[model samples]
Target: MKKNGGIRFLRWLILFAKRFLKDDMPASSAQLTYYLTLALFPFLVFLINLLSYTKLSTWSLTEDLLTVLPAGTMQIITSVIRETIEAKSTTLLSFSALFALFSTSRAMNALNRALNKAYRVQGTRPIWKNAMLSFLFTMGLIVLIVATLSLMVFGQLIGEHLFTLLGASVYFLHIWNLMRYFLPVAIMVLIFSLFYRFMPNTEVRFSNVWRGAVFSTIGWIVASLLFSYYVNRFGSYTRVYGSLGGIIVFLVWLYLSSFILLVGGEINAVLLYGDSKIK
Candidate 1:
């Protein structure tokens, strides 16, 4: 039975690979990278402008972003924010906000198309409806980012205070420390699951999508960590690309992220629709 199970798993993996290549995910990921790169700076500007109206500090957001983004990429982003602040032009801010909204919506729309390809589904939604949904998704994504930053910034203080009142043990404090790491991971899974469930044109059950969501969350974290390690320890993009090195590295990282995200959708597609020939 164990041997049969192993064989079945191997066959499934092979089928997945074949379909992944057939879908030309690498090209699709490149397309996503383009839209994402275009949107990224404007989104940052929009975020900075929006934060000016709130009490939240940009430093918190930067720290959170650094957890996933390379230090070089963070430097670029931080420098942009700094320059934006120095300029302090109300018109630039206003334009950035509008442009950010439109570009981010386009990025989300591109992502929707890619995922549809993964699931082998046609674009059923009308252009206007798709545009509105993408716009809403972009807004929700911004809220999610802010909420995550807020949780990371304030969660510990709240936890400590509550634990003090309860007279929690030292061991409980250690567990809470562990939860600090888990919280971001949990949020990642939730985000992936939500996107997988709703982003595609077809109806996807929660049960069918959970596996892909978990796979994507884990794959993304692992890929980011490995990429970060290699870039920091051995890789020298600056030596090869000079001043544009940071941008190159950032694009590569985004491509990797895009590939993994779509692969997760492919996983779900295979599981839901692939034949049981192996079994």
Candidate 2:
């Protein structure tokens, strides 16, 4: 039974690889990277505007991004945030909101098409319907991002307060500190799973999506860590590209992320269909 299981698994892996290549996922990822790049700054401006009305407005959101973003990318993001704050205005906010919606919807449409291709489904949804769904997904994604960031930023403080109120041991914080990192990962898995299950125009069981979600999450985390290390140690983008280095690095990172996300959907399609033909 063990030998048979291993053989079957190897066969599945081979099939998945073959189909992944046939799907031309790299090209799709490139398209996604373009739309994502266009949406990114607009989305950030919209989020900042929304957060300005909340306590989190004072929080340095870029600080958290520094963990994974390259120095050049971080510099660009910091500069953008500073400029946005310095030039805050209702007119700018409204314009950003509209631009964000339009750009994010385009990004979501790209994602939708990619996932549809991954699942080997025809995108039969009308343009308006797709636009509406993309808008909804964008809003949901923005909320999820804010929530995740809030949890990461305030989770420890909240935990400490609760511990103090409950008269818990100080050692509990060490455990909380460890668990905090894992918690965001869990949320990320949930987010990805939800997207995998729904973003595609097909019915997918939660069970079918969970494996892909976990794979994508771990793959993304590992890739980001490795890339960050590479950037910090050997990359001299600033010397090479001058002020534009940051944008270049950021686009490369987005491309990697987009590829991983689409590949996750491909993984789900493979597992769900098993050894069946993928066209």
Candidate 3:
């Protein structure tokens, strides 16, 4: 029975790969990349504006961004943030915040369409309804991002304070340190699970979404690490593209991210609904 189950699992995995390729992942990824390129700076400006009203240190926010972004890309992003802050252009900030919200929703709309295609469902919702949903999802995503950054910036401090208050041993600090790494992973899983559960038009069980979310999150982390390593070691984009290399690299990263997200949606579709529609 175990052997049969293993064989079935392998078959499913193979089918998923085939489906992912056939699903026009490249086109969808390109669309997402375009939208993201338009949205990136605006989104960052919106975030910075929101953070300005809070007690959170902008330095911590930059640090959090640097953790996930490639070094070259992060440098470009940081420079933009610094310039924007130094310029103190409220008009630009306000315009960027509104534009980012709408543009991000537009990107989410594209994602919604991709998810529907993955599930073999035609979009039946009204355009306005879909737009509203996308808008909500965009807002949710921004909140999730800010919350995640806050955790990364302050989680250790909070943990240490709690431990001291509880009179815990020094070993607790070691455990907290370990948890700092896992905390981001856990938050990512939660975000992915929510995306899987709600972004698609069809009903998906929480259990099924969790499975795909975990798989996708691990895949994304692996792919990102590998891509980062390759870029650092062998990439010569700067030599070829001159000053535009960083932008190119950022777009490629966004494309990879989009592909992985759609792949994850496909996995959930296959797992929940089988390969009947995906063939």
Candidate 4:
């Protein structure tokens, strides 16, 4: 029997996606992503509103940082920040004081459960224990996140300064290319480290965390770019759906974030599930 080339290609693609996506791959990822996003939706809304009230979004700080970059690059970064802030909605702010810690913890439980369900592993952490762990871990995570932002900020500053001093130096150009690769690794380490330190039913392996973080972080960046492209090209939802656009976009991003969280669980499962290693 002659195999159809197109169908054969499709089958391989499906297998490839499943291997990387893990278990139910896209479907499982999507389920956890959507569920967790819906749960965390209000927190995001509150934070955005908080940022608005503080007028932090209109740029008092990045302007100082941008002075070192060429006008063109500076303009692009500033423009994206400006447009994103301006597009934010005030109605979302009304829900801020309404957030309950107890409820939020439950939402976190949902995330934990989603990951467990996807991989068929039982998570044994008590709710209070996981919540405490998540909270303390969040402080470290936030610090690392802030440090990454600083690294990124200082990185551009150094680059701009180097270009000013070195002008056409070919060596400087090569080093700049190297920064791109190393920076992503650093960012992924922070991301995966947080998940490793916090997400497991038991203590997690560092190697598992690293793989999950690196893979999922890369997936997230690619997904976000594609999502933006999609919204710009095919979605008129902001104008068409109004406030609901905020909900939809928020959901989309959260869904992806949750999926990334699950990837850490999947990695842990790959290593620790069944057999004798876990004991």
**lDDT of the candidates, in the order given:** 0.81, 0.82, 0.80, 0.56
True-vs-predicted CA distance for residue 110, candidate 2, Å: 1.2
Q: Per-residue CA lDDT of candidate 1, range 98-207, in tens? A: 88888888888888988888787889999988988888778776776666675677777767886899998878777887787687778778778878888889999989
Q: What ordering of candidates by lDDT runs from best to worst? A: 2, 1, 3, 4
Candidate 3 accuracy as TM-score: 0.90
Q: Which candidate is the best by lDDT?
A: 2
**Which residue pairs clash within candidate 4?**
none
Worst 10 residues of 2 by lDDT: 53-62
Worst 10 residues of 3 by lDDT: 64-73
Candidate that beats the other on lDDT, 1 or 2, i.e. the better one: 2
Q: What ranges in model 3 sit over 4 Å off?
A: 1-6, 52-56
- Against the correct fold, how does model 2 do in TM-score? 0.90
Q: Model 2: per-residue lDDT, tens digit, 1-279?
A: 999999999998899889889888999999989987888888777667666766664446547746787777778777877777777677878888888788888888888888888788888888888878888878777776766676678778878997899898988888888887787788789888888987888888999999989988999888888887888899998899988888888888888998999889899999988656575
Candidate 2 shows a clash count of: 0
lDDT of 3 by residue, 1-279 (tens): 999999999999888877777777778878977887788789888777666767877877778657666656777888877877666566877899888988888788888888888887888988888888888778777776766776678878978897989999999988887887787788778888888888788888789888878887898788877777777778898899989888877788888888888788888888887778865
The positional error of residue 126 in candidate 3, measured at the CA in angstroms, is 2.9
List runs of model 1 lying over 4 Å from the truth.
53-56, 161-175, 275-279
